[model samples]
Target: MGQFIQKTSFSEKDFLAFQDKLHQCLEALELVLERPGFGLGEPSIGAELELYLLDGEGRPVLENQAVQDTYDDPTLTLELNRYNLELNFTPLPGTGAPFTALQQQILDNLAGLNQKMDPWQGQVLPIGILPTLQERDFGPQVMTDLPRYRVLAEAVQQRRQSTGIRIEGQDSMNLVHDDVTLEGACTSFQIHYRPRGQDMVNLWNATQLVTPLMVGVSANSPLLLGHRLWHETRVPLFCQSIDGLNSQSEHPVPPPRVSFGQGWLRHSLIELFRETVQLYPPLIPILSDEDPLAVVAQGGVPKLEELRLHDGTIWSWNRPIYDPCNDPHLRIEMRVLPAGPSAADMAANAALFIGLAQGLSEDVEPLLSALPFSYARTNFYRAAQHGMGASIYWPNAHQNSLEERSLAAVLEQLLPVAEKGLIQVGVNKEEAQTWLSLISDRLQSGQTGASWQLQQYNRLVGNGHGNHEACLQLLKAYCHHSNANVPVAQWPDL
Candidate 1:
């Protein structure tokens, strides 16, 4: 979804042509994977940080274009909503304190945005979802003025046959809408891990198995549209926004665009690609002119644009990425992390995830094998609802019982595995301690961002403050602590 297209609406002929090119691209990918040393070499780390643009009063600001133009930086770009922006990072090798380096870049970019927003009274906030958001804010008029976004909204709406998108968490958020613009309400800090000389299928499956555990510790979004919902309401909000038909209909129901996955990868990435092509219909079918097979036949890398574009449409929590261009490596995109509380907090979350992935991948038995995929899937949603308070089932190292344990207890045991994993992946012991220790303290303190926000919000509401007014006050306090560069666990309650 990060990529762009020349047009929005597609004709039948255009779709057919695009499908043909997509098949050719898949064939090229297969041929490329067959070569020895394919996607080999050093691992790299990268990320995409999505942000919200807020006004002086802590409300969403629809001035992204002006802010983007004034701050003319290549790393910054527009998101699905006009009030949203994204910051991208150049891939760096997974050695040293890459998380620190990434954090520094984010701070610098954030400072630049702050400076540019000063004149317009627009401020940049790193958050999962703006607390001040209202249903009225999601009208089609507020969407980014991009044809591709419009086409997506129309397509999702068409597939639903005008049925409203509905999600029920702690508070039910239902929308009788005609488009998928509700997705724009969510923001995330997406971390990318490029593995080198490793079995990507196993790494991906392992990541999926542990994603619920990660979400449990990193939950940050506790409020949406003044409603107290899940720790990360973005999960259900995003899934329901683009949801389509079910099996009860005339046609078989394909998985939701935003999904955990159908099942673990059986053969390799090829199975993923084949499933995508067969399940999802093309939305942006603007075909590329380059013949991928011809380029590969001449010992050259071909940009599998069709395959990538299609892959982007499937919003798997953990997605497989194929970079046949400049980087020329295969990477796993961890889409479970949310934005903000602080840069240090975000980096700690990243450290925990990458380290856990690396450490867990080293085990002789895959984590997925030990835990059922359905259990993993269930754990993800449960964690989303209950955050650290949730009791999640894990394959115990000592016993054969299928008993459930608190997320805190699970993290206590898993944190060491992540620390070892980071060290194993060339991260200095000091650097790993610097970041991973924050997560450890958070677990011990029982002060995840979500918990902090919910407690503060409840306190303010109890003090006779209206929901809207209290949210604004909370945002102001959040900004103060976030800019202080302290981990969220250290933040004071209202």
Candidate 2:
């Protein structure tokens, strides 16, 4: 709960005891749901933004981890690679247009972060993929000296089957090896929403249905290793980067740790993790001892260190998460979204999610029964696979290309339902529409960071320039836009 919390190591006894405590946590959650978790009835939303460090040329700027040490902000943390930094925002209490409030916090935090980094000529940037990222950036030496990241690197490398990369399109890149940390080139903007109650069915269905929508509007990872693959290259790159199976296990079957998702979630949050532990053995064990039961027995709060550590190991897009940080009031977080070129964009993405979750919560069983579970399960994959390029097949059952349909199309289509859903929960119409509009306008014009990056990269490559120049230009423009709090359109012609 405080800065630099102690990380617990894995033990079978701790694991089982943690599981028992986890069950206790969930039981407490159910009781609180009857009274509304945390006295803030229904889902309250939050977001996490990941960013890149760039230089004047728009290339990634390596930092002396000491760069952050100078800033003195606890929320500012190092990412796996030195070139990346993650800004963890305090949970945003949703007022419908979460972005309105969320973006202000991001702007204030980023400005503060930049002011701290300014002396080194380094600045923050949000791009699907760092335009200037190269193989040189991924060496083990470049990974931050943090114990957690170092441990994670070794765990992923040891457990991974192969470092399979196949990014082919305007630019082609295919690689297969035993290292996956290179996939760290991909940066994401993750957002979280409390689902009020264990509305698993709605959560699962909305998670699935919004796949195409999430993709259409927020596809920033269009290029990787200087190669273009799908509109959102992060889709393939991220998946293959950490794939943890041997060549013998390559043939398609449900993956053990790297989930393409088994099926729609219809059970408790614990069920999802239970299924995960059953399917994949622990990857990396850590050091820990704050027995959750010990805390419960003492009439004190438990950190659930063992369970939290295990939960940290499993990564799912629409992951079923328990918010033990706020005992008796935990929420699941959706981590599939890519970080953006703008804070407004990120907020819009959150609005659409919270709205859709509200819109679809009551319609789950009927919706799931009517729609294919496979579609819901695989929608996020498709979103990741072809961001803004794939078609979302809706329950009324119509498919539309992300590029062709535009964000407004999805917003117009889903907003009414979202509004109705939110209104049903007393979250007035004006609040819902404000945040949703950012998404609507952004999508209508095909102006996502991914789309903009693809356009600029293509323009550069089409004109016979190497990636070095292309990325440099893109990064420069992106930072300017981010600083101005302006959309990509107002960033002006390259």
Best by TM-score: 1
lDDT of 1 at 275: 77
TM-score, each model? Answer: 0.95, 0.85
In model 1, what lDDT does residue 166 have?
56
The superposed Cα distance between candidate 2 and the true structure at residue 161, in angstroms, equals 1.6
lDDT of each: 0.82, 0.64
lDDT value for model 2: 0.64
Clashes within 3 Å, all models in order? 0, 18
lDDT of residue 76 for candidate 1: 88
**For model 1, how does the per-residue alpha-carbon lDDT over 342-391 read when each residue is reduced to its tens digit?**
99999889899998888887562545556677787788999998898888
Which prediction has the highest lDDT against the true structure? Answer: 1
Inter-residue clash pairs, candidate 1: none
